[model samples]
Target: MVQTVISVAGASADCPEWVLIDLQGSLETRHPVPLSGRFVGDLHFTQKDVPILIIGHHILYGKTVHLEKPFAVLVKKERSADTSMETDQNVSGTSYHVKALIRRKLLFKTRPKPIISNVPKKL
Candidate 1:
């Protein structure tokens, strides 16, 4: 298996959507990676509670992991894979910035139904 590294550019709320990722200066090839779930790791204070994807052998979150910088990460494809290359180094000393993107609002309308009732009234 070939090893590849990609920087986490951003994430989309819609599942099964193609997220944009920058491959850190390497432009020889491109591939579509289907992301099913978020990445798992002991994230730093900046990375906590953020959405991420598991690419190649690293758990990438935010834009904290630079495209041209080298960082240590856990190397495993499946949950049963041997996690021996795992390390405790994160995008060292990098601060995280959270930005919220606005999405189109969904408006739903329902038709009013006629009311029919039968009741006895006392005078």
Candidate 2:
């Protein structure tokens, strides 16, 4: 039987960059629904590379921090092969591959502020 070994991808320039964003708070939905693949907000950067997050009518400011221990995003891959023709035994196994590494994170610990429009009233 062929054995497959799973390991994290070495840190290299070819690896895709990944960043973890911490809101420092819990997210709540209106009707307690799943939030997978949902549109949350837009993240913008200032001239000094400071991160600004805009969610609905609230705006939050955050900073990037390096993690002490990096995290690896992995993907599972399965393979099936017939090991013996007489016995017709199938060899199936799964291996994980590192997709990306999270070395830094954007942290928004402070409370979000409301975005006010500065529109002038006409007489």
Model 1 CA lDDT for position 26: 29
Best-matching candidate per lDDT? 2
On residues 80-100, what C-alpha lDDT tens digit does candidate 2 reach at each position?
Answer: 454334332343266788898
lDDT for residue 5 in candidate 1, whole number 0-100 = 38
Error of 1 at 60 (Å): 1.0
Write down the worst ten-residue block by lDDT for model 2: 83-92
Q: What TM-score, to 2 decimals, does candidate 1 have?
A: 0.17
Candidate 1, residues 39-95: lDDT per residue as tens digits?
Answer: 423333343534343333344444422223222232223322234345323423223
Estimated TM-score for each candidate = 0.17, 0.66
List candidate 2 segments past 4 Å from native.
Answer: 1-5, 9-13, 76-95, 116-123
| lDDT for each candidate structure | 0.32, 0.80
Which pairs in model 1 have colliding backbones? none
